[model samples]
Target: MPASRDQADRTQRVQLPDETGPVPVSIVHAEPRWFGVPPPLLLFGLAASLFVLALVLLAVGSWPSGLILLGLSALLTAAFLETARRRPGSERMRAAHSWTSSRLELAREHAKRLAEVQGLRGRRAVIESERRS
Candidate 1:
């Protein structure tokens, strides 16, 4: 049976350090082959074209050429599947780690700006009170 779309595409919730506390982030795990392999469109197109060429060769009475092309196409498809199955989980983890780190840095920067603004507001209130006295 084929794997479901949910199984192929997984989402993980990661806790990243922030200025205030740990922040929960949802990270969608994209295709494993996205960064490592050729585009799916290109791979599929090549396989399909090869299959079609094989059929055309067979129609033209070139049995040997047709068989060779068919075998090549099958091998290409199997190689792609094997690559996907053997892809390391470490790559995905690394990508998620980088994404979380960047988000955490942004949160810290925002918190720092907010703290500065609050400090300015407090100073203004003190000045106002002194003037009223």
Candidate 2:
């Protein structure tokens, strides 16, 4: 079955305690792609731009310098792709962690009475007890 909008909305919203003096809390969401470009495409673009620059340098200047730039570009492109490969997995993990935490917070809040009435030993009780510690 499809998930309910109410559960989705709870994850989208954040609650923070109000106090006279306390540090600010912020939630940041990472986008799946950088600047709307997928990592592979971005890597390609980086390499292409560098290759073009290296050609221009070779044409206008020296062969050694142009080759250096070309090599640097390749190295950079490889490094970027290596690092970016792990982003999607980390993003998925972060999102799952956030949703579960939100559900637990809601259980602690809305299920307090229900838990007490049900003799205080269920998922709700676990949530409430976790909140106290």
Go through the candidates in order and give the C-alpha RMSD of each one to the true structure. Answer: 30.1, 32.2
Error of 2 at 130 (Å): 87
**lDDT agreement with native, every candidate:** 0.69, 0.67
For this target, which candidate reaches the highest TM-score against the unseen true structure?
Answer: 1
Candidate 2 structure lDDT: 0.67
Residue-pair clashes per prediction, in order, are 0, 0
lDDT of 1 by residue, 1-133 (tens): 8766885577778987566767677899775445656643345456668979999999999989999999987766555444434553466534544554466589789999999999999999999999999
- Tell me which residue pairs clash in candidate 1: none
Residue-by-residue lDDT tens digits, candidate 2, 1-45: 876678555555578778878768999997555464445545546
